[model samples]
Target: MTKIFIIAGEASGDVLGYRLMTALRALRPGLEFSGIGGARMAEAGLVSLFPMQELALMGLAEILPRVLHLKARLRQTVQAIAAQKPDIVLTIDSPGFTLRVLKAVGANGPKRVHYVAPQVWAWRQERVKHFPGLWDELICLLPFEPDFFAPHGLHPVFAGHPVLESGADKGDAARFLARHRLGPEAVPVVLMPGSRVTETKRLLPVFRETLALLAPHVPNLAPVLAAAPGIADAVAAYTANWPHKPVIVRDVQERYDAFAAARAALTKSGTSTLELAMAGVPMAVTYQVNPVSAWFGRRLIKVPHVAMINLLAKRALVPELLQEQCHPEILAATLLHLLRDDEAAAAQRAGYAEALASLHAPEGTPSHAAAKAVLSVLG
Candidate 1:
């Protein structure tokens, strides 16, 4: 029996970890699986060594207060992994926490396979130089990622973007509009704050303010808030006092449908940008961090654009409003532009093709490709 210990620190990583676990089960049925993950991975047979949320902390400001707790979890995780002595130790995303745990595991640790290569190309280019010694195999999701890591004595296998599959099966636009009481003639703007509670708390107010700014100009604007899983109640509570409450779509299928039907979107800066692009929805991306964190990030971030769609396209496909620029008026203006200008919307939608093509996998599914890489490392 194969012993596979996995670590997935957040919602996105949990989803990917679940998919990879299912694929591994398909290849080797009797494998023993244990890890740190959320609900999705729990359903995929991961008896988490610790509550995954303990390691889900992000951003410098957010993580500062939790340093002692994080270090404690690190020690706990390291002790667990050492005692288990699994054939493979797979860490997915959350480099801050995962890498520390990996370092503690030492060189003699089980075949270390890391999924979702860190964005060294954007910042911290020096990480690539040291990464070759940390992990045994690197499984990347982007086609161009291998070029960045391979030259550093690390052979990365491009398993295609996981979003490619999730984006493929979307809901019906007509069904979504009707269910949300949105008329076909009315303009619908989708607001995706983020999947996490912290993200929702940070961005929902700005999104709400942005919507208010647009309401006067775009009459009868039907705003639908796409509630990321497990955070629907938080989204609702935050928007409870609004003059015109945004319709919250919590269902997975309905959220995708809402994306398809939306004229434009105001989303946080992350995977949602790519999700909107996959749905061919024009959007303006916005993000905010603690002022000190923003100041630190400004120095480290080398990329011209922050959105993945723009990164893959090597140009700005959509407007990005970050930190101080993520104001209601500015965000609303760009979204209003997307709603009003067909030419601009069409141009942004056109960028999606190139971005998707860049994420296209050659033969196998991303989960299977990732599983193969992990298995190869174990052998």
Candidate 2:
């Protein structure tokens, strides 16, 4: 049996990792998988070395308190990889943790494939200098990434954006509405604060306030909070006192159903944007890192827009209300505009179509393409 150790640090990575596992298994069944992942990967039968949440952190200020703990996890991971001695190590995203694992395993160890290339091209372009020897191969999800890394002596395999195969556009809206006892008249709006606890805690209150401000204008506003994996109970507790308690969507299918039923979305800037766009749901992206992280980010971030949809469009297709601009009133106003204005919503949908067309792989589904890429690395 060929041993392939995999690691994924975030909810999004877990999903991507799970799909990759499924695809790889189809390509090579009886391949053994170990290493770290979350619920989805667990479903794919990976017994994680530690709780993946320990590495699900983001932002400088957010991660500072967990620095020592993260370092320990890093050491533990490297030691685990060394002991396991798998034929190949697939570290999915979480560059803070995965990249270190790749580097520590080194060129001398098992061949390393870092799935989901880090966004070094967006900010801190200088950091590209250090990426040369970290992995034997890099798997990139975006279309533009291979060109970005190629110039730097890194030949990344483009697996295309995984969101294309996510079944986001296939959600049954009638089933979703009937499942939730929501009427056709009810305006279902998806509230995706984020996948991380820090993001959920930070953004949910603002979402609540936005709902409060929006309730009067929108008739029978049926709110749905698309909770990320393992956060349903926490999301339940966090949203207990909201203006209107949202129907908390737990798993992938439910989240897609919610996406289908949703008229619009108030979401954090990330893969969720791509998912919403794929579902043809209009959205306003919002995010906040603590003041210190924001301060540093302002100086380093080279990109004008944070939403992946907008970034792919190479212009602001969706409204971005980040940091100081992520106020409840602003969120309510932006969402209201999307809901009430058909022309504006249609314009965004048109842009989404134009941008998303670029995300398809040169070959089969993204996971299949990625599986092919990983297998090629094995040879």
Candidate 3:
């Protein structure tokens, strides 16, 4: 029997971890999986050693109060790895918890693979020194990451962006439109406020105003919202007063269906952009954080672009409206341009193709490529 210990913290990591587990199992049957993960990974048979939320804390402020609890969980995770003595130890993201556990396991432990290399290139270049000794195999999602790490005396496998495996393009748009009772004249617009509560709180009001502004121009406009499960109710509350009520989809399948039905998308500047790009939806990215955070981020961020698609394309493939530029008027105008201009939309889709092609693995899908990389540890 083959055994592997895997740990994933936070929702995104959980999704990636589940996909990797599914791919690993497809390649090798009857494999044993044990470690920490959320509900998604549990579907793939990872009974988490502790609540994944324990390590899901994002900022230092959140983690400081739970230091003792996290320390104990860390010890427990270290002990579990020692007891299982699995063929491989796989850690996905959550540099706070996963990296510590990997470090504690030491170089003498079973072959270790750390997926989603930390974005040291973005801000924390100094953190790169500690990472060289952490993982036997480093699996990065971005195409540029292997180049970034190789120069630092570390070899990494670019497994392609996980968003490619999202099944975003496989949605039944006709069925989705029919189910929503949208007619041929109706134009479906996808609204991705964000997956986090803070983001939804900031963006939904602006999104509502954007919709109100575009309604007269876009005939029979239909809004489809892609919201995270935790923030769904909040999204509902925020959008209750909007003129055109959005059909909010909580999970991936529903969101993908909505994406397929969409003529254009208004999304925050993140992975949601990639999701829209994968579904061939023309979009404008918008983001507004607290004044101070935005101000600091402007200085700290090394990259020129905010949208991942643009970053990957090495050009302004999509419009990014940030901070003061993220007003309802700007977002509304940006979205209206996408809905009205066929040539501009076509150009964005072409760039989407170019950007997404960079995410293709040397063979098969990204998940399969990642699985092959992880399995290489044994042979």
TM-score of 2: 0.98
| TM-score-better candidate, 2 vs 3 | 2
Residues 70-129, candidate 1, lDDT per residue (tens digit)?
889888888888888888889998999887777777778787888998888888787667
TM-score to true structure, per model: 0.95, 0.98, 0.90
Judge candidate 1 against the unseen true structure and give its global Cα lDDT, from 0 to 1.
0.84
Ranking by lDDT: 2, 3, 1
RMSD of 3: 2.5
* lDDT tens digits, residue span 1-379, model 2: 8999899999999999999999999999999999999999999999999999989898888899999999999999899888989999999999988988888898999988988889988899899999998887888999889999988887699988888999999898999999989987999999998889888889988889999999999978999999886788999987888768899998889889889889999999999999999999999999988889899888999888889999999999999999988998999999999999999999999999989999998899999999999999998
Runs off by more than 4 Å, candidate 1? none
Task: Name the TM-score of candidate 1.
Answer: 0.95
lDDT (Cα atoms) of all candidates against the true structure: 0.84, 0.91, 0.86
Candidate 3 residue lDDT tens string, 1-379: 8899999987778889999999999999888999999889998978999878667554344457789999999999999999999999999988888899999999998989999988878875777888888888899889889888987776699888778888988888888888878887879999887765557777888888888899988878999988776568878877777789998787888888888889999888777888889899999999887676676667778877878899989999999998888898888899999998999999999999889888888789989999999999767
Separately for all candidates shown, the number of backbone clashes (residues 3 or more apart, or on different chains) is 0, 0, 0
lDDT of 1 at 57: 63
